[model samples]
Target: MSSSESQDETHLTPSALGTKAHWDSLYALELTNHSSNPSDIGTVWFSDSDCESRIYQYLTSDDLSLSPTTTFLDVGTGNGHLLFSLLEDGDFEGDGMVGVDYSEGSVELAKNIAEQTPNAEGVKFIRLDIIKSSTELDFFGSRIAEEGGFDVILDKGTFDAISLSDEMLDDGSGRRIYEVYPEKVAKWLKPEGGIMLITSCNWTEDELVKKMTSSNSGLEKMGRVKYPEFTFGGKKGSTVCTVAFRRKA
Candidate 1:
């Protein structure tokens, strides 16, 4: 963890937006340059479990609504690599795909990558911070709610990064992201939607399930657990955890 900046916990909640410097510094470095295999972002992270789980969700599930006519959003998208990977692997089409990030550099890098692939043309990267500019959710949620909802919403680490700052979660900024973001995500989902969250923090699948489950709810009615839809155990035994959540029917 790099200790360079301090956060105003009260004002900058996970829902709150990030600052300019906050994102610029993050995008200053080229992500592909650091990874051993720039092509394989997941492997370069040196993790396997979470990446595999996420891949399964995209490849096997309708989470991204890739019905040759689906449309969706990628919050806190870095270089738009995840969406890029989807275009390559899923071979699925959509009305469009939009990626938003606080870092202008990252947004542009994603755009540059999109140019290399034809299917990814609709994939536009927006240089906006989610913490500051999630208001669109209100307009979008209603739209999805009325229009059969989005098939999927995928988030790999937007919430995780928010956890790294000062006290809010670490202290009194409030609760764990695993606890909070899920609800916000639920609100964004299109009723029968799905959310695939990949994380590298200390929380386990069971813990995350419980957190997402109706809080204060009992054991007999534990949130239904979905067995790992996809598993990838690479050279690394245990790495990150990818928990997939389906909007309850």
Candidate 2:
């Protein structure tokens, strides 16, 4: 669980990414709401109705599926809503899940919620920024490697957080996201692990694959197979999410 975003950059905005202020404001509002409710941040734009239902479909399927004892990472875990959604799911059967976020308030709320929630076993929430190439990524990777690389890593809105403005993205961050992210995920993931990324960019599944082909040497170098995209709610067309999955290489 890692989040990467700085607060000072006001000029640059990738459409789907969250600024530090955005998160700060979100937590400021959520502070009054408390984290004990079934769903703390119910109306977050990131978890739009379409995306919300779509995420459940992903979780029930092989995207985040795990045994009774598999470790998981939920990136950009805002208010622990997505993670809580999984916890509330009647069909979930995983072990040792953790969420990471940048907002201190959100992180504290999430930690409190996970600690107090019923049936939320083996779940922990931490506060850390994944942007700026911080050690949080290394910290997660090392922690996983020390025990076991996460069997599954799920990114609900993180990359969308990275789907940035042309100028801010031009700072080598977007390309680095495309380059280092996949490899980094693989490094701390099991050989038979899974990575699921859900995004709302205009890029379709094939367009994303093509972009990744050029940006990520590790993805190209490793002979990993791409699973076909899964349509949510039996909808045929893309549903604001271009989810890509690959076995750890």
Candidate 3:
């Protein structure tokens, strides 16, 4: 394949949503709005599709056999709503949940919201850029670090935003930042039975599976969160897709 073709296959066009400034500014405004109205929790990202509820159902399903003590990490946890919702709707315990974001404003907003949320005392929100802090993932906490990794890691639109960035890795490999994302985050999962569930609106189910199961990611398809399918011009697809992966044995 030609270099251009390879680039096109691996990268998505850059957009403002891919930048930290965009989220910082938006979350800053949300923090202000939330101060006056505790009910205002900012954007839920794909709420129209009921993405969060479906994700919750998928985790709570009997097939997974996940328990309330299962540990979780939410990457790019904007407003930390996914983690919050899981605690609110599922039998999952809050002590085992954590949310991390690169934007300080996002962390602040989530932390503030947690204070007002019932049974949210154990949910911790931290600010860390997963891409840049690939070598320092131990910042999560002693429990997580001592446990080797989390039981499950979730990415709701985080990879989509990362893919939209045009930034390339600084390692002189000529690879875009998104290209290395799978390998970087996959290390945070426990080697035994850890799982990662990613929901994306930008990539098709096949594309998402390919990206997550790339050779270097050490992950394989475990399952998926099903959504209603629609046929457009005889092509069946959904507005979004959620895929689950587990570390290769």
Candidate 4:
């Protein structure tokens, strides 16, 4: 693995992790590591097995159905393993799948991984700062709209990253990026039945559901995937959660 993307962990402040430079540096190191060992894929959010199992189980469940023409969008797609898993193992024969991230290095690494994987043919990776408001940064948003929007949008850790970033609010009075995320995503998803699936470590299921149902978001909570339970100080909790929402018809 790349030295930066190694198993060794390090602590970072929210301010530091929120910058494009931070993620760029991380992926730059991972790209170098991937060059040496192309088989070693990096997982920035969580374990590959955990992500794959949960997403696959959700897609195949009666709650959601997929067809050959369904389209997918993956926000903040780190190493692109989620899409890889869906294509290679989940029988996802969708019309197309696109993965976007703010870090150019992250998108580059994703492209590299996609290029090397046979099942990832036609997968697209784009560099985009989705945290920025469309009024100031509308390129990615326009591109997504012009492409007819997506049937499913997957967010593994993008929202959590925004929630942890110090730059979430430029001014103390302005709305945070995390606060605008649901509405922004609503614009890129096909209405009526479009679905957005999120996996997070920083928020509980109820909190995410509340965010989705906020005024002007036009999203309704479908449900969430349960994780392994752990008890700490007599309280039950899980370190991670996956929640789903559908755009209003």
lDDT (0 to 1) per candidate: 0.52, 0.54, 0.89, 0.74
| Tens digit of per-residue lDDT, candidate 4, span 1-49 | 4423422132224666566777888898999999999987776566743
What is the Å distance of residue 96 in model 3 from its true position? 0.9
Return the top candidate by lDDT. 3
Clashing pairs in 2: 3-129, 3-130, 4-130, 4-131, 13-165, 14-164, 14-165, 17-161
Q: Residue by residue across 1-249, what tens digits does model 2's lDDT show?
A: 112242112222454244577777767677667634535543444543356555656556663455555567777677666666666765554246778777787776676666656677566777766554445334665557666556556666565555452323345443333334454444445545445454544555555454444333233322222233456688555435445555526
| Candidate 1 stretches greater than 4 Å from native | 1-23, 31-54, 61-66, 138-149, 167-179, 214-237
lDDT of 1 by residue, 35-88 (tens): 444453221231244463355454455434446555566767777766666676
Among the numbered candidates, top TM-score falls to: 3
Cα lDDT of model 4 overall? 0.74
For candidate 1, the clash count comes to 6
Better TM-score candidate (2, 4): 4
Compute the lDDT of residue 235 as modeled in candidate 3. 98
Clash count list over all predictions: 6, 8, 0, 0
Q: Could you tell me which residue pairs clash in candidate 1?
A: 16-131, 17-131, 17-132, 63-152, 167-171, 168-173
Q: How accurate is candidate 2 locally (lDDT)?
A: 0.54
TM per candidate comes to 0.63, 0.67, 0.95, 0.84
lDDT of 1: 0.52
